[model samples]
Target: MRIGVFLVAAQFPGMDSGDVLRATVETIVAAERAGFDDAWIAEHHFMSYGVCPSATMLAGVALGRTERIRVGTAVSVLSNRHPVALAEEAAILHHTSGGRFVLGVGRGGPWLDLEVFGTGLERYERGFAESLDLLCAALTRPSVKAEGEFFRFREVPMSPEPPGLRPVVACTSAATASLAAERGLPMLLGLHIGDEEKAEMIGHYARACPKDVPAPGHVAAAVAQVADTTEQAVATLKARMPEWLRPGLAGYVPVDGRPRPATDVDAYVDRLCRIHPVGSPDHCAERLRRTVERTGLRHLILFVEGAGDPAATLENVARLGAEVLPLVRDL
Candidate 1:
């Protein structure tokens, strides 16, 4: 039951992107003091949705600030990136963090990421496999040489090597989750699925996982929040919270004439109640424990307050860390 802070880098009103960057690093500093185990950064780009486009670069900043906490990408979009560059950067970050870096890889998303990159979704799965295979090869052996449909590497040794968690790659979709298991990699799940989905996906990984593997397949779910009261917590979530969500989001999101996401907190809550973990400290802790217990998920990454108001969001985090996290320490 280890707790981790996943830096979603959600935007706040009147705060510059740089301000959020500083806030993120400071939050990690505070989280370390609060006795957190690991910290993760997400991969999002070309939108106001996420601030840390270069997740590894920001992770390097965290490396310089913290001494013992582990750091890595919540996901490094593998499809849009070159395998060689991904390997080199992660290796450098690993050295920067004294071997505390673990690479979380993904094939980006279905529409927004793939469409933005001008790549078709039909072969997306194949590209994901290709990218993961290439990146892993580059990280493990020196003088890498390989060729695949989408990526190629040759005569390149990933110097100095990444330590601690070693070179790990993960993807979010269920099929990809099985792929991670096939390759003996850890898996990161999106925050917006139900209990049944969690059980089934995690179970899929476990079933496909090899018994002799060093580390068994892992499940990291991204729904976390803490507030003084459940009522107050729901109040803290803003009207515009759903606006920050990607347009390519899954589920029954109907149009409501606001260009993108409209005033659909009803539709929003339909998905959110399943994905976003929010509640008072006591309830939050107990619910989180139950979710993990049900799925046996070890890595828990929390996105506090749903990301609409940063100040209120931080307040939620302060309360959550102070109360809820302590309650779940042994559970």
Candidate 2:
């Protein structure tokens, strides 16, 4: 199994953006030193949920800092940027980083980001498949032309072509999973869903995937924290995560001028704690093993910043590598 850390650059209350960014980089470096296989960055905008606006930009920083560990985006919102521009960035990173850059793209929500980026609600709702197709073409082919509903352009030659650059798709539903499978791309499953839901999505992908294409290795995101005991790990997150999640979850504004549903912060956190690996090394290992057995996912990107403290988060990463990883690495 491949183990990785998911960096969100979560800006907790009383913490500045610089603090969050610096800690995020430090955590990535620490994760590399702790023998992690990859570091996945999250992109967020106009919200304290995650301060990093560009996952690719942060991925560049991480790739430059670490030589061995791979760097990738947990997801870059495809609706907010042009497919060609994103493809160029991915190609540059892939070449510069020795083919260690992984681009994970997602169809973002109907948030205010669409308005700010001048991509209307239609793009987020309907244009993602077109954008993804264009991106795949730009990455795989020497030159490409797009005459699609959302994008129309003459043939543009791809510079620094990334022939083997396989992008991962963030699949939150069956439609997205099928889309990814049809394209022969791996799925990056979210942390919110349980193992059964993930298994179902995997089933959907298996059914839709073409026979000629080799099966792709899917990635699963999970929240993790290592401590001396189960109670300590649970207490640490319960104390800090809610304060950070309360404002962050409530900050998203719908672009359609409709009221968004309220998220119960405590309840959400409770669910995460229950479903994820948050405990001692042995307990964490057991949880991860069960997840692998149930979902058949070998790639795991663990979210370790829920403690909302730089020192604690770093410790969590180190302990995960030192203690929990060995217990589950052979699985």
Candidate 3:
């Protein structure tokens, strides 16, 4: 299986913007040294929740630093940018990186992203579909033509022929996953759902994909921490979980039905560990293997720097690279 790191440019309580950016690049370098196949960058804006506003720019920085490992955006929010500009930027990066650049696309989330970009949440999905259509046409065809509900464009041709780029979609729902299948694109699944939900989503994608066409290998990202013993891993989670589960963070809402308060550290840690791949090397390897078998995921993107605690996060990356990765290398 192909394995990689998903760089989450998370800003901890005391970290400045520069600190977050530096650490993100450092994580990419470390992942390359650790023998990761790729490093995917995420885009976030107008919040310390995630400081990186341009994942493509960060992907360029990572490409400049690492020679072997592939780099791509975990997702560049399509709803937030003009498709032409994004296609041009990504195509340039792809050319510059010798075709190692991947253009992962997604709809900007319903929260701060849309509000700050002056995009309406009501039309977000429609806009996303329209954007995806335009983006695909722009990246593949010599010229672009769109008369969709959300975007209207003339026959504007992209300069310098587009490369052979296979884009992936960051899918959070079965509908979007099916959309990926329809477009013959791969899907990137996050670790926010239960195992049953994951199974169902994967099954849906597999079924929706055409029988004559080869199914694009799907990727799944997980929050991970490994140590000598399960107890040690749990201890690290206990220490870092509170900060990671801070209130108002996206994707982390209810602490069992109510909004999570800052004090709900233990409960939050338990919840996170229950759904993520966290344990000793052997333990993690077995779980990951089962995940691959069950979900038919060919790539696993490990989020090693879960809490943004530099010391612990780096150690987790190192240990995962040294211990866990070798054990599960064949998976």
Candidate 4:
């Protein structure tokens, strides 16, 4: 399986945006030196939750700094930007990166994005689906005409034509999974859910995928921290990860659109660590092996930064490269 680092680029309290972004670039550079296959960056806006407001911009910075290791957006929210604009930028990025750019698209935070962009929430899913369609077409063909409920374009020529743009869709529900399958796009699953939930999501996608098309590649992401012992890792996470795992972090609604069991902060943290891959190098390797075996995943992206101090995070990355990665590189 391919191993990648997922950089959240979150600006913690007391840190400036410049510091956070510089740290993220350094992390990617470090990951490449540590023999990682890829570095994925997350996009967030108007919040310290993630300081990389534009993941595409950060992708450029990462690509400029590193070679061999692929760099991509963990996801560029489709609802926030115009499809034509995004396609144009992605096409250029794909060429500039020497075909190393992977455009991971998603429909995330309809409320915040829509409110900020002054779009209606009623068209959230439809607009995103349509935008994705337009983007896919633009990436492949030279000129295209699109007239959709959300975006309209006529005789648009895709300059600097994208070659082999392998877009990955980030899915959180059965509906989104089916959409990704219908488009024959690879998936980027998040670290939020449990094994049973993941199995169900994968099954749904498999069943819904068209038979004529090749099976889509599956990727799973998780928050990971490796130390000499499990206790050390847990303690580090417990002290430093509170800002990221708050109750409303999942958004206003449960991911599955159903009522969720009420839980306190400590319970939530416990559940998150349990669901995600968090432990010593040996233990993390075994857990990731089990996850890959169970899900038939092609790639695993670990969120190895932002959950702790810079020193601790860097130590985890080094240990991951030296101790954990060797154990599972061939798996």
lDDT (Cα atoms) of all candidates against the true structure:
0.68, 0.92, 0.77, 0.79
For each candidate, give its TM-score against the true structure: 0.85, 0.98, 0.91, 0.92
Clashing pairs in 1: 143-157
Lowest-scoring 10 consecutive residues by lDDT in candidate 4?
A: 247-256
Instruction: Give one digit per residue, the lDDT tens place, for model 3 in 1-331.
Output: 8888887688767778888898888888888888888988888776665788999999999899988889988889887787778888888988888888988888756554565566656557577777787888778888887787777767877876766577789989888988888888888887666556777888898899888778788777887888887777777777765674563164433212444334465776676676667888887788788787777777888877665577667777788888878887787
Q: Which has the higher lDDT value, candidate number 1 or candidate number 3?
A: 3
lDDT (10s digit) by residue, model 1, range 1-331: 7777888676644557788788888777767776777888887775556777888888889889999888878888787777767888987887766787768877765535565565556446568777777777777766566677665545665676633243445544667877788878777776667666877887787887888876554646565655567665554554445555533133212122223333454566546544456667777877787877788777687765364665655665677678877888886
Candidate 4 or 2, higher lDDT = 2
Task: Supply candidate 3's per-residue lDDT for 124.
Answer: 73
Off by over 4 Å in 1: 110-125, 162-170, 214-217, 238-240, 246-265, 270-277, 305-307
Against the true structure, candidate 2 reaches a TM-score of 0.98
In candidate 1, position 59 carries an lDDT of: 88
Write the residue-wise lDDT of candidate 4 on 1-331 in tens digits: 7999998876555667798898899898888888888989988776666778799999998899988899989899887777667878888778888888888888876446666676557557567778788878877888878877876667867777745475788999888999989989988888777666777888999999999989877777887888778887777777767655452244434323446555476765677677767888888888888887777776889998735556666777787888888989888
Q: How far out, in Å, is residue 175 in model 1?
A: 1.6
Q: What are the runs in model 2 whose C-alpha is more than 4 Å off? A: none
Model 1: how far residue 118 lies from native, Å = 8.0
Task: Score residue 105 of candidate 2 by CA lDDT.
Answer: 90
TM-score of structure candidate 4? 0.92
State in Å the error of residue 178, model 1: 1.7
